[model samples]
Target: MNTYTRTHLAFSMLLSIAGLSLPLGAQAADRMAGKMDTDGDGKVSAAEHAVAAKAMFERMDADKDGYVTAAEMDASHAAMKKDGQATDSPMSSADKIKAVDRDGDGKISATEHEAGSKSMFGKMDGDMDGYVTAAEMEAGHKATMGGKK
Candidate 1:
């Protein structure tokens, strides 16, 4: 299996730091939605996304200088580890885009993102239920990692 290199670290950090790289899956995207979506709606609107983005930026911009340097990111991630909130590195940007770019257009449009999520949801929803429980989440991740699709 291929692993993420150090170069991909910046991409992963940026995603976690700014919450811009919302996952293609609805569940993954909404993993933080409980804290992000102030409303009880299952979907995150543009406004809610904006608020989450601002909060992520603020968290990383600890110095409040409007600039998040590499050192700052390291510091913030270190803090996250101390708080036991840290996790493994993400797939490389190229691989991630390829996984979702079914049209092979090299660019994922809004439609493609939604479609990819739907497809993944179908594969993960083993019980054929509308919702995917935590068990299904692990199974989905494993299947995805194992190149099920």
Candidate 2:
């Protein structure tokens, strides 16, 4: 198989191991925050959030090309679905990439991903604290989902 196929398979396996099968909603956000809580302190610190974002970017960069194209993002979401994981987000792959695609490249560079992730972290940190609680994460998720439950 090609690198893309292999990467998708690997990501699917990881999803299976993690048993992540929820849509991108409040529940998923809470679970994601819980996983990012490396210290198990009932919240996610900025460092922990950054680590998670980097890992996610690596996984989405299926070709290891240091950038994530819309096709790669779609493939990653497909892999998640194949693994019984639900990535039900309102934004399309292209739209997601566009949201963070600096320079209008239609792809996400590592720097762009980090900047977007940092911005998201700031949004999720409701109280302007350096950490995000599950409740805050849920609220942020809902807001991003346009208040969808």
Candidate 3:
């Protein structure tokens, strides 16, 4: 092949790979939004987000102890990774627990989780429209990750 043709091919391949990687974060956000959009509305209403958060709390409370320890959160993240779900959270499990561990209990109670989820929903709503679209969700995730991937 001519040098110019080879260079063009390499550039095209690089672009293709970059494009594929670029959507991973967006895709992860879309998947999360889809899961929380139980009503098939293509967006997560406040109620839907609450329900999803409750369900998540239940899942994370593996011992049914009404609280999620950092260990539990880590285990949940591990399970998500094992199941092929994207668990690329920027915060560690301990950091997550600390963020919402109201009263400094070193763990997350259901009430705390609910409160945190509510706060997160409010932030992710962006326009204060009482619903979170996929775009908003992606933006929120990015913001939570400090605008990192």
Best by lDDT: 2
| Candidate 1 regions with alpha-carbon error over 4 angstroms | 1-14, 18-30, 90-149
Clash list (residue pairs), candidate 1: none
Model 2 reaches what TM-score against the true structure? Answer: 0.80
Give the per-residue Cα lDDT of candidate 1 at 147.
23
Q: Judged by TM-score relative to the true structure, which candidate is superior, 1 or 2?
A: 2
List, residue by residue over 63-131, the lDDT tens digit for candidate 1.
876544445555766676577555433544345445444466654344444444444445545787555
TM-score of 3: 0.80
List all candidate RMSDs to the true structure.
9.6, 9.2, 13.6
Each candidate: what lDDT?
A: 0.47, 0.66, 0.64
Model 3 segments more than 4 A misplaced: 1-24
lDDT of 2 by residue, 2-40 (tens): 654433333322222122324445567677778889999
Candidate 2, residue 30: Cα displacement in angstroms equals: 3.0
| TM-score of every model versus the real structure | 0.45, 0.80, 0.80
- Candidate 2 displacement at residue 18 in angstroms: 14
With a 3 Å backbone cut-off (N, CA, C), the pairs that clash in candidate 3 are none
